[model samples]
Target: MAVRGAGRVRSEVLSKKLYCASSTPPPHARHFADNQCQSMESFFTRFKNVLVLVAILLAQTIGLAVQVRRPVESGAPDSSKVTLIRYWAVSVVSPFERFFHGIGYTFRHGWSNYVDLRHTRQENHDLQDQIARLRLEQASFAEDAMQGHRLQAMLDFQQHYVSTTVAAQVIGTSGNDLSRVIYIDKGSKDGLKTDQAVITPDGIVGKIRDVFPHTSQVLLINDQTSGAGVLLATTRIRAILRGSTTGQILINNLTPDNRIKPGEQVLSSGGDQVYPRGLAVGTIESIKIDPDHQPYTLIQLRPAANLNQLEEVLVITGTQTTLSAQAQKDLAAGVTTAEAQAAAKQIADQQAAEAAARSAAQIVADRLPSIHEGEDEAKPGTAAPPATTPPVSVVPKPLPTIHSDRYSPGATPSASDLKPGAAEPPNEKDLN
Candidate 1:
C-alpha cells in the first residue's frame, strides 16, 4: 500500500509538472515574446549594411589614432617610420593609374611623332624653294657684278666725253623692222630725258625717244627716220648721214663735185648738237651720182656702232672739254682765229719746202760718184774726202729756219739778203 501511494504521488507530481509546462502562456506574454522576436529580426535585416560600414569606420578610426599618436611622440615620421596607410593606398591605386598613364603616354608620343614628321616634310619643301630662289639671286648678282665692271671701264675711258652718266640695262627691243628701237631700264626717274644722245664706247648708238619712270625707248641710228650731221674725215665736207627705208645708211646732200670714196672715214660734225664733234660716225661703203638730183652724190656708209648686237650703251648726259680753262684764257691773249690759221698755213708750207729739200738732198747723195778701192783701203779715220761736185747738179731751195722764242727778235731773215743757187758752207767732213 505504501509503495502504491508513493508511486501515485510521484505520478501526480509528474502530471502536475507536465501539465504546468505544457499549459498555454498568457496572451500578453505570448504576444510580447512574438513581438520581441519579430522586432529583433527586422532590426537586423534593415541595418546590416549600415552596421558593416560602422565597423569598418571604427577600425579605420582606431588605426588613424594609433598612427597619429606615433607622429606626435616622434615629432614627424621618418622614412623608416612611414605610415602603412600611404603604402597601402599606393599599392591599391598605382596599378590603375600606371595603366591609364601608359595609355595616355603612348597616344601622346605617337601624335607627337606624326606631327613632327608632317612639320619636317613641310620644312624640307620650304627649304627647297628657298634654295632655288637663292640660286637665282646668286646668278643675277653675278651678272650685275660683271656689268658693273664693264661700265666702270667705259666711264674711265670716256671721262672727257661724258660729264656724268647713269648705268642702264638694255631690257627689250621694238621687234619690228619699221621701228628700230630698244628699251633701256632707265628713265626720267633716273635723269634720262627725250633726245638724250645714247652712245657706246665704240661710237654713237641712238637717241632717247621716250622716257618713263622706270624705262626709256631709244631710237636707234639705223632707223629710217634717223639722221646725223656728219663730215667726211679726209675731205672735211659736211653731209647728212640718213637711214633709208631699206635700212641702209647713206650720206646725202653731197654735191657731185664732192669727192667721196669707199673706205673714207666719216665723223660727227656737232652741227646737230646731239653728238659732240669728232665722234666716229661710219666709213663710206660705196658712192654713186644721182642723175635726177643733178648734183648730189649718194654715198653709202657702214655705221660705226654694231647696232644688231648692242648690249651696254652710254647716255651722254653732258660734255666735258679736253682743254683746261686756263689754256683758253692764255690762248685768248694775242691769238686771233685768222692769225692762227695763217700761222698754221705758213708752217705747213715751210714743212713742205723742207721735205722737198730733203728729197733733193737724198737724190744727190745717191748719185754721188764712188771712191776708188784704194780710198776704201785708207785708214778708217784718215780717208780723203770725196769730190763735192756730183754727176747731177740738183738745186735744193733753202728752207726757212724757225728760231727759238728768245732768238726770234734777232734771227729774222729778209729776201734782200738771200743769195741764189747757194750751197751749204764747207765743214770739216767735206775737207777730210
Candidate 2:
C-alpha cells in the first residue's frame, strides 16, 4: 500500500511539470528553436544548384548502364541497338565538325593554288628572258659567220694576186650619189698614194684621189671625173669607162658596130696603169644609141662591187713583184751563167731541127699525088685505069735530120705533124 501511494504521488508531480513545459516555458529554449530554423533555410539556398548538377550526372550514368545491360534480340538489325543518346550526340556535333573542316580545306586548296600560280608565272618570265638572250646570241653568231666569209674571200684574193696590198675600212662617204666618193681609214702614213688602185674581193672599187695623214679620199668608178680603161670579155673590144653626173657607169667611145650586149663582163685593161690587168670592172647593163652623139652607142654597166655599201677595201701598194723576185732569186742561186748559155744553145738547136723537119714533111706531102673519088669510080661497065709509075724527076724528098744534143728516148711524135702520104717527122729517138 505505501509503494502504490508514493508512485501515484510522483506521477502526479511529473505530469504537472510536463504540462508546464508544454505550455511554453523558458526564454533560452525559444531563442534556440528560432536560430535552428534560420540556419536550415540558409543551407538549403546555397546547396540547391550543386544538388541539381549531381542529380543530372547520376541520371546519365544510370541511363548508360541501362543501355549497356540491355539484351539484344536475335535477327534484329544493328541499328536497333544504338541508343538515342549516341545518335543525338553524333547529329548535334557532326555539322560543326564538317563546317570547320570545309573552311580549313578551302583555305589550304586556295593557298596551294595561289603559290603554284605565282611560281608558274615566274618560271614563264624566266623562260622568255632566256629565249630573248638566245635570239640575240644567234644573231651575233650569224653576223660573225658572214664576217668570216668576207675575210676568207679577201685572203684568197691577196694570195692569188701576189701583190703588195693594204687593208682599209671605209670611214666616210660623200653622202651624195652624185659625187660617188668615199674615204678610207688608211692614208699616206699607211703607204697609200694618189692613183693607187682600190678594190674589194669581188672587183675593183676605185682609185685613191687625195691622200691625208690618217685618211684618204677615193674617187669611185661611178664618179663624173673618174675614168678607167676596160675591155669586153668576149669581144676584147677596148673602151673608156667613165661616170656620169647621175652616178651611172658609162662606157664611152663605143660605136654601134662594137656589138656590145647586156650581161657581158668588162675587165680592166691596165692601160691607165692605175688598176692591174684583168681585174673585174663590171657587167654591161644596157646598150642604146647615143642621142646627143650620133653613131656612138651609150653603154651602161653594173658595178661588180657593192659601191654604194662599201665596207672594207684593199689598196694596191705595189705591183706583183714578189713572184718575179722569188723567181729571180731562185734562178740566180740554182743556175750558173755557163749552164744558162748551154741551155739556150741547146734550145736554139732544137728549134732549128723542128723547123727543118716541118719543111721537109710539107714538101713530101705536096709532091704526093692524090686520086679523085670521081676518077676512081669510073662507069660500072668500063675498065678501071691502069696504075702508072711516077717519073724520076718527081722523086720523094728526103726528111731533114734533127740534131738534138740531149735526145730523150721517151719522145713521141706530135699529132699535128702526122699527115697522109707524108714522111714521119724526125723525133729525139731518131736523133739519138
Candidate 3:
C-alpha cells in the first residue's frame, strides 16, 4: 500500500513538469526565440534588392545556356523558335530605351538647328562684308588698270614721234577765262624754255610762255594772246589760228576763195617757230561769213587736246635742231654714205643673180626636144622625119643697142625698139 502511494505521487509530479514545458516556457528561452525571429526579419529587409538581383541573374544565365545549347539554323530566325525570355526582355526594355533616345535626339536637333544658327548667321554676315570689301578692291584694281592703259598709250606715242621730250605734270592754271593758261612742274632747269611746244599723246596743247627756275607757264592755244600757224590737211590752205576775246579758237586770214569745210583736219605749219610741222592742231568746226570782214570767211576750230582737263604733257625742247645735228654728225662720220653703198651693192648683186638665172633658163629651154605637127599620130613602124641642122657658120642676128640717155628707169620698152628676129627685149625688171 505504501509503494502504490509513492508511484501516484511521482506520476503527479511528472504531469506538472510536462504542463509547464508545453504551455508556459521559461523567461530566458522565450527571449532567445523572439530575438532569432527579429534577426531573420532584419536580414531579409537589408538584402531584399540583392536577393532580387541574384534571382534575375540566375534566370538570364539559364536562358543564355539554353540558347547556346540549341542548334541554330542558317538564314532568318524562325519566329516559332524564338525564346520567350528574349521577347519579354526586349518588350520590357524597348519603351524606356526608345523614350530616352528620342529625348536625346530632340535635344541634339534643337542644339544643332536653333542654337547653332545664331553663330551661322554671324558668319554669313561676316562673309557678306568680306565680299563687299573684295568688290571695292576689284574696283580699285580696275581703275589702276585703266590708268596703266593710258600710260601705255603715251609711251607708244612718244616712241613714234622720235623727239626729245620732258614729261611734266600740270600743277596749276591761270584762273581767267580769257587767258587760258596752265603751269607745269617743269622749268628752265629741266631744259624748258620759252616758246617750247607742249603736247599730249592726243594732240598739241600749247607753248611755253615763260620759264621759271623750277616751273614754267604755258599759254594754251585757246588763249586770246596765243597764235599758231595751221594748214588744212586736205586743202593745204594756210591760215593763222588765233583765240578771240571770248576764248574761242578762230582761223583768221581765210579768204572767201578758200573752200574750208567742217570736219577738215588742221595741222601745224611750223611757221610761228613754236610748234613742229605735221603736229595735229585742230579740226575745222564751222565756216561762216565774218560780220566784221565780209571779204573773209570766219572759221571756227576745235582743239585736239582736252585743254580744260590737262593732267600730263610733254615739252618739246627742240626736235628739229637735235635731229639735224644728229644727221650732220652721222654724215660727217661717213655712216650714211656707207649704209647707202652697202644697200646699193646688195641690190646690184641680186639683179646680177637674177639675170644669170634667166640666161641659164633660156639655154635649157632651147636645148629641149621640140615636137612637129603629126608626130603623135605617126605609126610606130614608119621612119621619123630627119631633123634639119642649121649651118654652123650662120651666125645669129645681133640685137639693137639701147642708148643710155634714151633709156628711162622703170619705163616700159616700146614694141618698135624690138627687132623681129632678135632675142626678146630686156625686161623692165632687168633695167631696174
Candidate 4:
C-alpha cells in the first residue's frame, strides 16, 4: 500500500508540472490525474482501431483478388467497379497535383523565373537612372560655382578702375560679317547710354552705341569710324586711332612733332573726356613714313580687346559723360538723323567699292597688265620703283640738318605721305 501510494504521488506531481506549472492542492491533483488516465485510455483506443482495420483487410483478401482478376481477364463490362477505382485514384492524385501546382514546381516554373529576372532588371535600371541624374546635378553645381568666381573677379576689377561702373556680360554677338557688336544686359535703366566706354579685363572693348530699357549694344573697337586718342607708352607721343573697314585701325596725321615707333606700347592719352586715361589700345605693330615727311609715323593699331573673344565687360559710368535721354523712359536711344544718313552713305560707298573691285578683276583678267599692278601693290619694305615713272634727277640736301620741328611744325604726315623710303620717323611712344 505504501509503494502504490508513492506511485500515486509521483503521478500527481507530473500532472501538476504539466497542467499548473506550480504547486497544486491535493484536490486539483486528483482531477489532473484523472485527465492523464483519460488520455492514456484514448491512445489505446487508436491502437485498437488500427488493429481492427488490419483484420478487415485480412477478411476482404479473397474479395479484392476477385475484383482485380475481373479487370485483368476481360476488357469489357464491370464499368461500375472500374469507375469506382478511377474516382478513388483521381481523388488521391488531384490533391497531390493541386498542392504541388500551388508550389509552382512544374510547367510554368521557367516562365516564373523569367518574370522574376525581368523585374530585377527593371529595378536595377531604375537605380542606375537615379545615379546618372545625381551626377548631372553635381556637374551643374560645379559650373555655377565657377561662374560665381568669375563674376567676383569682375566686381573686384570694377572697384579698381576710375569710374562708377556697370558690369555686364557679353550675352549676344553679331557674326564676323556686317559690323562687330555685342549686346550687354545693362542699358538706359542701369545708367548706361550711347557713347559710353565698354572695357574688359584686358582693355577697351567698344562703346555703347545703342541703349534700350534693359539692354545695350556695343560697337567694338574694330568697327569702322570708331576713334580714340592713344599715345605711345614709351614716349608719351599722341596720335588719333581710327578703325578701317578692312580690320585695320590706323593712327593718322601724327605730325612731324610726335614720333611713333614700331613695337612700342600704346595707351589712352586722356585727351578725350569719353574714355579714362591709360586704357590699353595696342602695341604698335609697324610704322611707315615717307622721307618727304621725315618726322611723323603712320601707326596701325591692332585692337587690344580681342573683340572677337570678349565675354565680360564693364560699362564705365559717371566719368563726365552722360546720355541725352537719361530721364526719358520708353524712348528709343538711337543715333541722330544726320548720323544715320552718314552711316547709310558709308554703307552705300562700301557696296560701290565691292562692285568696282569685281569690275576691276574682270578688267585685269581681260587686258590689263597683272605684272604692273602687282608692283604697285608691293609692301613698303620690299617695294621697287615702277617702270611707269620717269627717272627724275634730284639735288642732294646737306648732311644731317638738325633744327627740326621747324618745317612742318606740329603738322603730322598723312597716309599718302607714308609711301616708302622714309627716315625713321618720330615715334609716338612714352619714355619708359
Off by over 4 Å in 2: 1-162, 321-432
Off by over 4 Å in 3: 1-162, 321-432
lDDT per residue (tens digit) for residues 1-432 in model 2: 999999998996676456445647368776675555446545766798998899999998986675553464211112333524433543454445446645765786898777547578788899999976765555445445445546867776432233688998776676677678787777778888888889998999999876665667788989887889998999999999988898888986888865667999999988887888789999999999889887888999999998888878999998862245654454343344435555788999999998788677656654654334344446667875563433324434333336542233225555676688987666554566
Model 3, residue 316: distance off in Å is 0.5
Residues 1-432, candidate 3, lDDT per residue (tens digit)? Answer: 999999998996676456445645468786665556556656866899999999999998986675553454211122433434434544454455446645766787899888877578789899999976765555445445445546867776331133588999776676678678777777778998777889998888988876666667788888876788898999998888887778778886887755667999999887777788779988889898898988788899888988888878999875732235553453334443445556888999999998788676655544543333234346657775463443333333323347443454335567778778987666555678
lDDT of 4 at 330: 10
- The C-alpha stretches of model 4 lying farther than 4 A from their native spots are 1-161, 255-259, 290-297, 320-432
In model 1, which residue pairs have backbone atoms overlapping below 3 Å?
385-432
Report the lDDT of model 4 for residue 323.
20
Give the alpha-carbon lDDT of every model: 0.68, 0.72, 0.70, 0.63
**Poorest stretch of ten by lDDT in candidate 1:** 71-80
Per-residue CA lDDT of model 1 for 277-388, tens digit only, reads 7788889898888665757788888888898877678897877744345533434432443355557889999999987887777677555534343444466687555855
| Number of colliding residue pairs in each model | 1, 0, 0, 20
* TM-scores, each model vs. reference: 0.38, 0.39, 0.39, 0.35
Residue 189 shift from truth in candidate 3, angstroms:
1.3
Clashing residue pairs, backbone N/CA/C < 3 A, model 2: none
